[model samples]
Target: MSKVVMYVSGFCPYCAMAEKLLRARGVAEIEKIRIDLQPEQRAEMMQRTGQRTVPQIYIGQTHVGGYDDLSKLDRQGELAKLLEDL
Candidate 1:
């Protein structure tokens, strides 16, 4: 499976949902960067993703985006392919 990284906060439902979806698709480990604990990382996330959101998700090198974008990819039947591309 691909390496999964996510910029998230403790209280974000979307982040939790994204994790659940990823796990459902067979992702074993997620490298979670908690921005609530590290405020400076939030700036880095925005710079890299251009989105000020709780769940800035990346599958390998592809920016899979937030929960909505991730789910859209799942609905389009690309999530599994993305996750397994590594």
Candidate 2:
């Protein structure tokens, strides 16, 4: 629905989980930035999201935090609405 970007590491379980959830929610394209491969991407992610987490997710211009936060929004049934806005 929107442009999805995530900062991920190869071995991050949360990254995997977040990716699964997004796919389940009908996100077709995800721009994944591997912070482990590109260390400078971590700096860019931190500066953009103000977090150093493995799965820093952005839906359009909205910072959706990490896996847990994404789950919370999904559970609350707010994620679809957010995606619609995107």
Candidate 3:
């Protein structure tokens, strides 16, 4: 599986959901960047993703957007392909 990184806040429900889904998809580890703890990372997250939202996820180097986008990819059967290690 590919590396999973998520930019998240402490109280974000979507972040938890995204993580749960990722775990279900065989992602053993998720590198969670807690923007709630590191405020400066919020600016970095927005700068990189162009969205000021919790749970900005990345599968390896590919930006996977938020929980909805991740769920969509899973629903469409693309997430599995994306998670496959090269």
Candidate 2, residue 6: Cα displacement in angstroms equals 0.6
Tens digit of per-residue lDDT, candidate 1, span 1-86: 33999999999999999999999888889999999999999999999999998799999999988999999999999998887786
The candidate maximizing TM-score is: 1
- The reply for model 1, stretches above 4 Å from the true place, is none
Candidates in order, TM-scores: namely 0.95, 0.94, 0.95
lDDT of 3 by residue, 1-86 (tens): 33898999999999999999999988888999999999999999999999999899999889999999999999999999999852
Total clashes for model 2: 0
Residue 13 of model 2, lDDT score: 96
Which pairs clash in the backbone of model 2? none
The Cα error of candidate 1 at residue 34, in Å, is 0.4
Off by over 4 Å in 3: none
> Candidate 2: lDDT over CA atoms?
0.90
- Per-residue CA lDDT of candidate 2, range 1-86, in tens? 33998899999999999999999999889999999999999999889888988898988888999999999999999899877776
